[model samples]
Each structure stands twice: as C-alpha cells, then as structure tokens.
Target: MDALKILIIPGSARDGSFNRRLAEFAARQARAAGQEATLLDLRALNLPLYDADLEALSGVPAGALRLQQAIQASDAVLLVTPEYNGFPTPLVINAFDWLSRIPATQEQPAGLAVTANKPAGLLSASPGAGGALRSMNFLRQYLQMAFAMVVVPQQFALGRAHEAFDATGALQDPRAVQSVETVLQSLARLAQALKTA
Candidate 1:
C-alpha cells in the first residue's frame, strides 16, 4: 500500500493547548505508521474573521487560501479540537467558515475542491470528563454538511486530558495511546482505500 498524506489540524490557538499536543501526537503516530503527515497550527495562520462584506471587498485572505490549498492537497484530514462550552472553539469554526466560501470558478462549485468527498477524522481533548465529545459531535455534523467523507464512526475523545499526558507530553495511559493509534491507523487505511478506488 502507498503512504497516505494526512493533515492534522489543531483547533486551539492557545499556547500549550492539550488539543495541539494531541494533534502532534497523532501526526507522530501517522508518520510512524509510514504515512506522510502535516500538522497545521490554526493560530499561526492568523486568518481574519469570516465576513461576507469583507470578502466582497478584499476577497479571501492569503492565509485562508493557503489553508484551502493545504486541505486540497491532503488525502485526509484529522481535526483535533478543544471544547468550549459544549462546542468547538471559535477558532475552528471561524477557519471553516472561511473555507466554506465558494470560489469564483466554474470547474468546482465553491468549497467543493476543499471538502467534497475528502476523507476526514474527528477527535477532541478537554480537561473535563467528557473530553470534548460534545464539541466533536458538532464538528462532525459540520464536516458532513460540507461534504467531507467522515469515515470513522469510532471517534476518540481524550477525557480528563490533563492527566492523560505525562511531563514528556506523551499519553501516559496505555489504553489511551492504543486508542489514538487505532484511530490514526483507521484514517490512513481509509485514505489509502479511497486513493485507489
């Protein structure tokens, strides 16, 4: 099987965010599994808030365009989200809001180039017991609406995330580690299948 290209996107912009740590861990695991992984930090993208008026005036920002290109080039996407009040962080939502805009082209309608039929996986991390599961639900629905092929029904949520990792930033629990690896492996396998299909 050929190595799949996977994009890992962390939804949090805060330094030392648990979600970012989880994304990094997933990227490492994907590479270890012989897949090519790119970890994207949304904070570094510095995207402007999505506004139709602003877009009409200035067009999609360069940052957002770069993000769209990255998504288009990847075989699969893994969203590592952090929950805030039972929903995904505004950073994640805002990024997608910009990504969902239809481009001024006829070849592919609007966001189709970035989202349509693209394989995606959802995961979440939080300091609470729920592990951002509620947030993942909302994110999954949004991705489905955008026409992404969300292949994994068995989503991974890291509950009590603070205790799940160690000083070295590795997941401390064996079971948690196994779960993460399993999800990533599933994503790679599905991406490979789709690539050859």
Candidate 2:
C-alpha cells in the first residue's frame, strides 16, 4: 500500500506551545512508522475570526483556502490543540468555522470540504491535570457530528505538558511516547482502509 499522507495541525501559535511540540513529535513518529507527515502551524495561517458578512463580501480567506487544499491532499489529519477554558483554542474554532462556510462547487460537495469523510485523530496537551482532554472530546464529537469526519478512537492527552517533553521535544514519559505511536498507527490503518475501499 502507498504510504499514508498525514497532516499534523497544532492549534496554538505561541513560540513555546506544548501542543506544537506534541505535533512535532507526532510528525516524527509518523515518519518513522513509514508514513508521510507534514506539520501545519496555525500561526502561519494568520486567519481572521469567522464572520458571515465579511465572508460574503470578500469570499473565503486565503488561509482557509490553503487549509482546504491541504486537507484535500492528505489521507489523514492529527489535530493537537491546547485547551482554553475546556474548549479548543480560538484559532481552531475560527479556522473550522471559515472552512465550514465555504459553498460547494461542482467538484466538491457543499461545506466542509476540509473534513468530510476525512480520517482524523485528536491529541491535546496542557499544563494542568486535564491534559486538555475535554477539548479533545469536544473536538472529536464536533468533527464527527458536524463535519462527518471519521475520527479514530485512539487519542492521547498529555497532562502536565510543561514537563512532558525533553530538550529535544521528545516525550520524556515512555507511556506518552507509546500512546502517541498507538494513535498514529490507528490513524494510518484507518486512512489506508479508506483509500483502498
């Protein structure tokens, strides 16, 4: 089978975001597992808040268009988000909201071109004990119900994220490393199955 093309997106744009480190680690794991992985930082996208009127006047932002194209090219996606008051970061919500507003074209169905039937995996990191698990749960449900994404059951939430990684961005906890590998493997299998189906 052809290698699964995976996209790893981190919700936070901060220079020292633990979620970004987690995304980088996941990308490396995916590559070592013989899958092709790309890291997409939300900061670089620089998307504005979602506004219907603005969208109507100016059309979809270039960032949303780029995100859609990235999703269309990938076989699977891994979303690493930082929890904000038990919810996903504003960047994530805004980006998805913009993507969901896109009208359908003859080539693609209406709305959610970025997520429809896409195989997705969720991961979150936080300094608190929750490890952003609530955000992960919310994203899993939202992505599955709202966008019809095929979200893998295998997910990871790294609690105490500030101390979870080493100097090289590698997870210090052996268990965390194992958990990430499991999620990647599950996502790869799901993506491959969908590709051959």
Candidate 3:
C-alpha cells in the first residue's frame, strides 16, 4: 500500500498547549511509519470568527480556502482536540464553520467535497482525567454526521497531558505511546481501504 497523506490539526492555539504537543508527536510518528504527515497550525491560519455577514460580504476567508485545499489533498485527518469546558475550542469550530460555507464550484462536486468520505482519526489531551475526551466525542459526531467523514473507531485520550510528554516532546509513558500508535495504524488502514473501495 502507498503511504497515507495525513493532516494533523490541533484544536488549541496556545503557546504551550498539550494538544499541540500531541499533534506534533503524532506527526513525527506518522512520518517514522512511512506516512506523510503535516501539522497544521491554526494560529498561523488566523481564521476569523464565523459570521454569515462576513461571508455574504467577503466570501470564505483565504484561510478557509487553504484549509479546504489541505483536506482535499490529504488521504486522512487526525484531529487533536483540547476540551474547553467539555467542548472543542472555539477556534477550531470557527475554522470548520468557515469551511462548510464555501460553495461548490465546477471543480468540486459538492459543498462539502473536501471533507465528505474522508477518513478521520480523533485524539485528545488534557491535564485532567477526562483528557478532553468530551471534546473528542463531540468532534467525532459532528465530523461524521455533519460532514459525512468516516472516522476510525480507534481513538486515544491522553490524560494528565501536562506530564505526558518529556522535554523532547516525545510521549513519556510506554502505554500512551502504544495507544497513539494504535490509533494511527487504524486510521491508515481505514484510509487505504476506503481509497481502494
């Protein structure tokens, strides 16, 4: 099978976000396993709040266009989300809101062409025991039901993420490493299978 192209998106944009560290670690692991992985920095995208008035006046922002193109190019996506009071961060939600508003063109078959049927892997990290799992659950449901994305059943939640990674940004616990690896492997397998199907 060919190497899967994976896009890793971290929900948090904070300077020292545990989810960001997890995303970076996942990218490295994917590359080491002979897959192509790109870590998407939402802060760099600088996406504006999702406002229908802005869309009516200016159309989807360049950041949303770029995000659509990125998703269209990838075989699968890995969403590393942080829980903000049991919900995914507003930034990531806003980004997706913009993406969903982009109209279909001659080159694109549907408005959700970039996301529909795409394989997705869900992961989350938090200092608390929940490990942002609530946010992950919400994302999984939203992506699958709203966008028709096919999410892999295998998922991971890194609890106590503040201490999960080492100084080098690598996962400290062997079990945590194994959990991440399992999720990635399942995601790759699903992507490959779906592509062939």
How far off is residue 90 in model 3, in Å? Answer: 0.6
Query: Candidate 1: where is the Cα deviation over 4 Å?
Result: 102-109
lDDT per residue for candidate 3 within 1-197, as digits (tens), equals: 67889999999988999999999999999999999999888777778888888888988788888888889989999999998889989988888888888888876644487899999999999999889999999999989998899999999999999989899999999999999999999999999898898
Whole-structure CA lDDT of model 3: 0.91
Q: Estimated TM-score per prediction?
A: 0.93, 0.96, 0.96
* Steric clash pairs (candidate 1): 102-110
Q: How many residue pairs clash in each candidate?
A: 1, 0, 0
Q: If ranked by lDDT, best first, what sequence of candidates would result?
A: 3, 2, 1
Winner by TM-score = 3
What is the model-wide C-alpha lDDT for candidate 1?
Answer: 0.84
On lDDT, the stronger of 1 and 2 is 2
Clashes of 2: 0
Q: Over the stretch 1-197, how does candidate 1's per-residue lDDT look in tens digits?
A: 66788999999868889999999888888898888999988777788888889999998776776678788889999999988889999998888888777585765446656777788888899998889999999888888876565657768999999888888788999988888988887877777878898
lDDT per residue for candidate 2 within 1-197, as digits (tens), equals: 67889999998989899999999999999999899999987767778888778888999887887788788889999999988999999989888887788778877655585688999999999999889999999999889998899999999999999999999889999999999999999999899999999
Q: Give the TM-score (vs. native) of candidate 1.
A: 0.93
> Candidate 2: where is the Cα deviation over 4 Å?
106-111
